[model samples]
Target: QLHNFCSIELGSFYLDIIKDRLYTMPADSIGRRSAQTAMYHLLQALVRWLAPILSFTAEEIWQHAPASDDSIFLQTWYELPELSSAGALNDADWQRIIELRNWVSRELEVVRNKGEIGAALEARVELWLAPADYDLLQKLGEELRFVLITSDAEVYPLTEKPAEVAEEQLGVAIRVVPLEDAKCGRCWHRRADVGQSAEHPQLCGRCITNLGDGEQRHIA
Candidate 1:
């Protein structure tokens, strides 16, 4: 159970946060900082929690962690924060998002098998949903694209079913198109604005805005 908590639950949660929220947000933005800070603390707690079963490995990780003490075994047992805490995703909301994501993944796989797109990030997705699902899906806003791991996403009310529609059970249809925009050199997200900036010609608009001062620092 502990291994599943660390490897599956925590791992997927962190990956979703990074891909959807952290990477998409401007580096200097408060939202990005808050997300990164939460991830840092979660990882710290995870290392300490795992120390009992993974003593040597956990201690090695703890030793290298900033502000960590002599031994991870000396640390108190990890306690998860309340669900109402900042940056927390409610269980129901996450379940709905996961279902939508799975729908997109199924469609992406169809395209991938035909060698139409190499990666989910390399495709643009169009989502058609029943009128009943529109409001719930709209609640996701722009984050829907990130959840689907696509270069672009467009949501529309379900009309006549197209031959390419992926799933019928959830009243959701997906269409994948190869992303036409050049991929940003820094972040690798395909964006039409990639070469528009004169100063940062190789970067997307988001990367250009975040790369202020251009002074690189190694985190380790």
Candidate 2:
């Protein structure tokens, strides 16, 4: 089960989710810090899990881990964070958001494979979603772009499925369009306002925001 967890879930998460945030956000931004904290916690938990079987490797990992723990034997399972039920977005909402993101990702992959876009970041995505789903994603505001790993993402409230879509897939539809704007040298995301600023003409507007106060991301 753990092997499958690592191979499938964590595999998609690290590559498709965390990597985007880490690469784009500034060094000291809250988003980057959040990703780093998640990675650290995951490492500690995994090291504990492997202590009995891969004793030498677990011990080696423990040695270089953040805290000054003497040995793997001296540790307990990593304490998970307390779950919040009263938040604006709950666990169910996040699961739904993941489902929605998967649809966008598949469409982006199709666009990339067609040679119309070099990367997800080179295209803008438009998501047409059921009213509830649209409202749920809009709570993320602009952070939805980061989650989809697209240059820009636009969500529209929708009611009915198109003729080609299956009945079960009624709530979601995605369209990808290649972007022709200048690419940011730092983040590599193409944007129309990339060259608007003379001081740093090659960077996107978001990059400029990150340079000073950093982007405020509540959810992704």
Candidate 3:
């Protein structure tokens, strides 16, 4: 049954169904990214079987799945993580990380509102931490910055005030600054535009469908 279920059309349809349900459900029901990532794992499982049948389509979808690298064909087949005995991730870790990510999004949006537009992960950021959380921040500075969508980040001394503060004190503050002259017109994030016409200024080839900034262009 599992072998039979793997195919490009089937895999994509499965993702569509799960994504639709996840987005349509109440926010309190589940985390959207978590649901989507679970869908990615399912798709990855099917990718091996589907790659020979639907090479192009599988690659296309795989590229959009952030968890994947260049080509699913190049990547090894998915193996279910063995969780039989003791080693396993618990819900609390996921919850804590989710909360941190949400807070990072909120803070990043606030910084972006202050004319930082399109500040992506890998942008230099300064994080102000509470004294109690300073050591933790120092230990995970790179990881936190990467997850929070910042270039480089440093956990500053506790007294630094964040531009936006949550209703309930997060005891953490973040500041993001876009690197100068590193803008890609397409994704608007700082990166080498792999697909730019000679005439275009830093446009990503992969993001051709995302033409016209600040304008809603329906892809479907």
TM-score of each: 0.78, 0.86, 0.39
Number of backbone collisions per candidate: 0, 0, 7
lDDT of 3 by residue, 92-160 (tens): 543454464566567668767776656454366665667755664454534454344454466776576
Q: Candidate 2 lDDT, tens digit per residue, 1-220? A: 7777677557764546677567767888898899888788888888889899889989998999997468998988889676556657876987787787777778878878899998899999877788899889888888788777888998876654445633237767777889998899988888888999899998888888888878777766
Residue-level error in angstroms, candidate 1, position 140? 2.6
lDDT of 1 by residue, 1-220 (tens): 8878666555654465455446545666665666677777887888977877888999899998878887888888767665554644467756666677777788889889999889888988887888756666676677666666677788888885576665547688777889889998876779899999888889887677666532221110
User: What is the lDDT ranking, best to worst?
Assistant: 2, 1, 3
Report lDDT (CA) for all predictions: 0.72, 0.80, 0.53
Which pairs clash inside model 2?
none
Candidate number with the higher TM-score (2 or 3): 2
The TM-score between candidate 3 and the true structure equals 0.39
Q: Judge candidate 1 at residue 142 and give its lDDT.
A: 70
- Stretches off by above 4 angstroms in model 1 are 16-28, 81-89, 131-133, 159-168, 213-220
Clashing pairs in 3: 121-149, 121-150, 122-150, 122-151, 123-150, 123-151, 195-205
